[model samples]
Target: MSKVPDRFLGYAFCVGDVLLELDMDFHIISADGAIKNTLGAVNREQSFLDLLTESGRGLIESSVKMLTGANRLGPFVISVGQEGLAKTEFAVFLAKLPTAEDRIYMVLSKPYRLGKSDSKNAPAQKTEDKKREFFNRLEGLFEGNPDAAENMLVTVLEASAGQQLDDEKRLDIERYLQSFSVGGAHATQIADDKFAVVHDKTTPKKEAADIAAELARATGVTLKGATIDAAEAKLSETDSMRALIFSLQSFASGNEGFAVDQIQKNCSTLIGETTERVRAFREVLDEGRFSLVFQPIVDLKKATTHHFEALTRFELPPIIKTQWEMIRFAEDIGLIDEFDYAVVNLAIAKIRKMLKKGGSPGIAVNLSGRSLSNQGFIFELMSLLRGNKDLKQYLSLEITESAKIHDLDLLSEILDEIRGIGFKVYLDDFGAGAAGFQYLKKLKVDALKIDGAYIKDALTSKEDRAFLRSMVTLCKDLEIVTVGEWVETQEHANLLREMGVDYGQGYFFGKPSPNFLVAPTAAAS
Candidate 1:
């Protein structure tokens, strides 16, 4: 096996992870640790890109041009081919060795599956007998319904650069447009001085035109309305999706092309690609092909690791939007409950193994609010947690995802029961949602994982700093612990600790890793 050079030690990797030395053209020059077996039937002429799944190939292929000693790419998880374990997924990272002009180092860690697990799951069976229905209720425009408009009413309003944009004015227009009472009557600023309002199936052409004219007068902007009816235009499912993309680009770029069929790519790519990805996502959950990475949440006062939040990572096939998109899609398609159960199982299993090794480590797993809202799924999840009551002390739930949660009263009661059994609950993404304060008022959580947005801006903006101070005060008054996210620098850590944020989680603490990385304070001692 090829040895890792001394120059690349600044970047870290596990001992058994597959590493490779590749030339400027990305051809493998040297191999180390399972690369041969992982790729299977490897050749001297084959580039490192050949082994990667589609998404991985594109990311690495594009990102290497800017790679330097100070910068590294990824630790991003993606699918890769492996002998027997065809479904093998790896956490991939690459860095430039300072002196090696013709070479770069690539590291691939088996983050998801172990001996029995593979990166690619068995192909999902396509059966005509099984019937299914899916709802992608895209009422808004770019995802604007990314500008994914698929058969939605789009109104573009162009504003002159008048004395800068008034937030109050923008909010007024937004609120008015949203008052249409249609699902996803969403308004977005696609570009500077350009705003797009998207409405779903219920939006009437006459009503939209009236609103557009009224809004153009009110806001003093040029307003235009356009719609691409897939059925009306005799477009296919794929073409409709493409039309949305073209329309969004045209509007954003200050161009005008209401007729979409001419610009729409005449290929069956969109529908086929979406179908393939959805199938791949299903296979992932069905085959249990996901993995967990632990990022330390440190107790700021003692400067020790309070616990590690087990963030779920996916090893999906090429050409997907994002990991989160897949997860959100799972929730939409009624598959998140299964994925959530799998996560809880994995978290507890890892925690249990840690206890056996005489290491009293704690792991927090995220449970989506959408899943918790499901009565049956929550009951099943509660039963599983209750069954493994012993691991309750080691395993906690970081309740995130406030979007789908409707019955706060029931959710609060459910959380109280979970906490009643000794498991601490942390409200994830606190202060990021409209109902954050409402959730805080109702749900009895032990801690708050403060949203990264506020934490990121705290050092730069006084208003944000005031917000942090207020949040800390609120948590203090409630006697709840506070965890600040996106804490990347010593400055961030210092300020958060000074502000009395109880815990800190970010790259400053440590990044998510396969194994439990010790807290910085713990490491120093």
Candidate 2:
């Protein structure tokens, strides 16, 4: 019998998720407690697929093959049950762990009952699927139209001085873009920090104008004439459609209007704010003027703290009180990577200390959006991880989807390098914007921290519940472990558990604190 690595066992306990390892021959190499408790002991020689429901075998196997290849497909949902027992479905996320031997590693979601006879779940699933379809069509309405010039009106707010928004502010802007639907105006990201709103001719020009005012008020950003009718572009007999689009690109560049003056005012305000932030950021860097407090992520099924998310706090500079303000300002000034590096180092230091004292709970540290595009910082990060190989499994990096990722291919390569060091990466605050799904498709994230809004309103709002169910179902289908943020009560936790949310974080579990360690006596109690 081959011995399983202690590190992998520690990983299973920290994630509160099942771990399964299979060889190239489709035979199980090992199964952790979660698997054993769910599916019973496994024989090493038994084929892994034989355990799955007959209907799901082929799909699961094919998805696994793609997962092992460069063109990896996302997670796959499959049912595992005996003939007499009702089938249970799980979303399974897989990764090829770097090892001397060829093997596939799986992170499995908790089982939820799935069958047509189950009346309780039928309507929710059906409604969510319909909603997803509607949104898909809405997205197409914004993106799929070939002759948008005829029916669509466009407005773009360009980023100045290579500055982009952090996730919170970007989501705020996206929300405002969709909030006013005068004559069914639809909004989509045509480019990074550049959004376009489209409405048919039926929409009154006044309503579109109101939308611009609404946007300006909501975001406090000035918009220049950047508006154009979809049909305004002249077609030439000699020029192709591509040439017409190239010409239209000039129209999108900028415009002349009162909004320009207001934008300059906004920029002036921003400049003053940026200077203050830069001074504060530098002081923190030189003096180590920050603190880290951890908020617990609870496993609903076990009612235990599976991990803690390290949150940063700055002091003495009354101007930068909130973590969001501090982080967002750092992002605006190209100092985010430095801030993220400091947080990661602090988190890793604490995590290492905890592990040495005989505890192995995981810690999730936030990585600022700007760090994704900074190759030098990424190289430094990779080197940092390589030097602390033992801490990899205990450490996870949380990347929020608030800002536009400038270079995804480069980010992907950086993540791959980090993953090669054995650490897990989580897509944090998912379902907040369009980028969530895009990142899911492009990256190899091990888990997802579902956006807090869905969890906060899930119990009271049917719409929120449906949205959550849909998001959880999507994550399950991809096999990504899910954590619900902003869970405030036992009722909320119980509701999320029923909905198949793997983990949760909120005041219901525990509050963020500087002293968040899992003491020996505390665990025993």
Candidate 3:
């Protein structure tokens, strides 16, 4: 056996969903600089949990052995089935890696597939059949009406290209064919290729391997072996790395093929799973799994607490570990509306709790544009508020300026109704949206929260400072209070104060806390 190169030896594998197959590749670089590759296929029909567990264990052991100098290895690259597949695969890979192998690099690649073509024997008869069908259809159309020969030719041209004929081209082809028919040269004018329909199908599987081999040549990895089962490969010291390379290549190609077939077979199943997850999340909302965290809004002039903005935190499943992941999953599964509604209700509940405890601080909660546009959501919210008069007094709704208010008339009517009910409205992230000024008169908002992007660099950037100053002036003229967010230091706070910003919020005042009522004596005053 030839010794593989030092640079190519590594354990790399692609991960995919249950119904979608996964392919893995192993590249082995022997001590003598010989490159060898191997391929692996993960069966999607089997239990994903069990397969993943086994694969993860193998990965950890291999990585540890490499790191301890028991074996030599290179970087591991993974290609996944879908968008979130990358994150899930990484998480599993991370969990399985030994502590000593923490420095091992991991790379992610875009999804790809192996090419498959029809059998050679099958194509000859199919092509002849299509040719007969085409000529027959053409003859029938022309014989029905001599004057329609032009239209029939245009149809044949479109059919050949596998697309609809444009009006101009159709008319031109019609005229040419009509001229030939009138001159009695139609039969002789037909080209030999025109009688037969040609179909350019994808290349065959073996041909695809050759193409992949060419690609691997550029990467300095050689195709060592191709097998149906990667795990069956002999894991000797010399062959281990080669096996890994072959596995990765097989996985990349096979996964692409599997993704298409799996989507066709189980698209509804996937959709149902997504819907169930969303439904479960909404159920969690109804069960009050959400809690409110408050961040202080400071009155810049008095240097005291103006109000507290309410943010929602959810107790997600172990699968969802990070804040971004949880929010993204919710958004992906179409549960953003439910999530936003839960946040509002949770914030309202916290406000009620605060009021009962004899602390009457103003509470602001964010409302998504989708929620605002939903008549049912607005009715449910209003009903909740009307049922509790005391909670309504302390409630303030903050809406992002970037929200696409599709039905402006309906939105304006809704805003009017919301104001009529005595709930204060704040236009969140002002200056971020194009029509911020235009919305001022249209929206019956009581406050404007300047976007954090503007406030963060206001002092250093003259343009930002000027924009903020102009915004402050515009708000004053309109009698709408302005609040600056992302005030991180005393300098930021001071500048906002000097510019007559009505309120400020960010790290300077306090970070978002689970306990809403905790306040310094000076801020409380």
Candidate 4:
């Protein structure tokens, strides 16, 4: 026996929404039909039935019965059509259906003549006219009685097929069927007959049908089927082949072609706008349209300077007036990484230059979670440090506590490797979110920078004070130094010092300055 395609067990019943899953273990009947299960299991059987019950299939059946009588096939067809519409409107709904089953029963009957045939360019014109009239009737039927729409649609399908449709003609018919089956605003476009009904829950069935018909008319192909054994056999050959074939057949041809053209139009417009923004950001970076600002860290006991945190400021042109505006534009155009990398490299170089000129205070540079988690970036930082030995001791790598810990083992190993070479690691914004004391022990960092939120409100709030104190004690136990950030006044600094915080950073000492300076003896004292 020939092997089945991997998706052979998956099948579509109704045009847009009636999908069925048939594997050895259990048979699953689904509406809003998209193949979901490649291999059936018993668990999936119960789940499918449960899903149908939840979708109110019973209610749908009752409604169809009221309109189409007890034959059930009529109601079943309408329910299938309704499911088609549901699939387009609700992504969540479609996601629930089994996508890998292929036991589909497509109904194709002889084509029905609506009017007397004309002989003038008759064959081509007749096909167009027939499609237009058929879709128009379908729209009216769907609007008037959605309960009976599926049955009527099936009736239309049965009436529309000529004795035996060639493969190309059958594909066109299938696309047309799918368009109406998956109804939404896009359904109205069925008149165009160029696009395939690639399922987009948001599109109207009429529009989708028009596009599908046109595409089907363009590309001569018909619906094809595969059994479970065939699909599994294909998987053994190549995993990508199935996905590739589906994408090409569904999106690149017939009714799908029209929909893709529309998508391409929208994408092109977005691409153009994004391109302009990217170009503008590149110009700014190229011209060094940014400045480095330093914020002072104070020593409470001596009322002296301890260190400075480097902050980046973009010098916007008159056209780009706001900091947020520039930043948002950069993010939208994929220039965020470029801008951040430039800031990092520039800050490092600036710190090195300042140290060479006898600047004494330690300088802290912020490293985004993205950069820190990147192995290439860590190596780059190491290379920079290697080239500038004199500034190594005075530099600290500040990282956010909430950054995703990508590959924890690798991150710990890298931290140890960097620390081994004399670079200090400070967990910035520590005690934020769910960051626990365990991270302090596990990460083996040199220091923890108390989140600014704790310092800003800890003075007045008992709860905040207790939390900060507990965190400070925890750090102490682990031999990890603690630094209080956003210290705004002498009282805040004094309170932090009393809490055992070894360092502080905020506006109280001095605002960020371009000129780097040593810690004043008074502050250190």
Best candidate (score: TM-score): 1
lDDT of the structure predicted as candidate 3:
0.49
What is candidate 2's local distance difference test score?
0.62
Q: Please give the distance, in angstroms, between residue 343's alpha carbon in candidate 4 and its true position after superposition.
A: 3.2
> Ten consecutive residues with minimal summed lDDT in candidate 2?
234-243
Alpha carbon deviation, residue 406, candidate 4 (Å): 4.1
Best by lDDT: 1
Tell me the deviation in Å of residue 94 in model 3.
Answer: 56
TM-score of every candidate relative to the true structure: 0.51, 0.50, 0.48, 0.48
Which sequence of candidate numbers ranks them by TM-score, best first? 1, 2, 3, 4
- What is the per-residue lDDT of model 1 for residues 313-370, given as tens digits with 9 covering 90 to 100? 8877675568887786666445577788889988888887887889768889998887
Q: Count the backbone clashes (under 3 Å) in each candidate.
A: 15, 10, 28, 71
Q: lDDT (0-100) at residue 117 of candidate 2?
A: 33
Poorest 10 consecutive residues by lDDT, candidate 1:
126-135
lDDT of 4 by residue, 1-525 (tens): 123333522432222322333332224433222333311232334433233322233322222222222111211121122222332111111211134323322221111121322222224433333443433333333333333323321211121223455445544554344433332211112222222221222223223234334444554432221111112212122212222222222332343332344333443332333344455567889999888777877666656766678777877765566876786555423245466667767877776676678765677776655455555666776676666666667777776533344445666777787687787888888877756565665688898898889889887899999999899888889898888988788788789989888888776666677876543435456
User: Which portions of model 4 show Cα errors greater than 4 Å?
Assistant: 1-271, 317-337, 401-406, 433-438, 517-525
**Runs in model 2 lying further than 4 Å from the true structure:** 1-273, 356-360, 517-525
Model 2, residue 309: displacement in angstroms?
0.8
Model 2 clashing residue pairs (backbone) = 75-478, 91-476, 91-479, 92-479, 93-479, 149-230, 149-231, 150-230, 150-231, 167-402
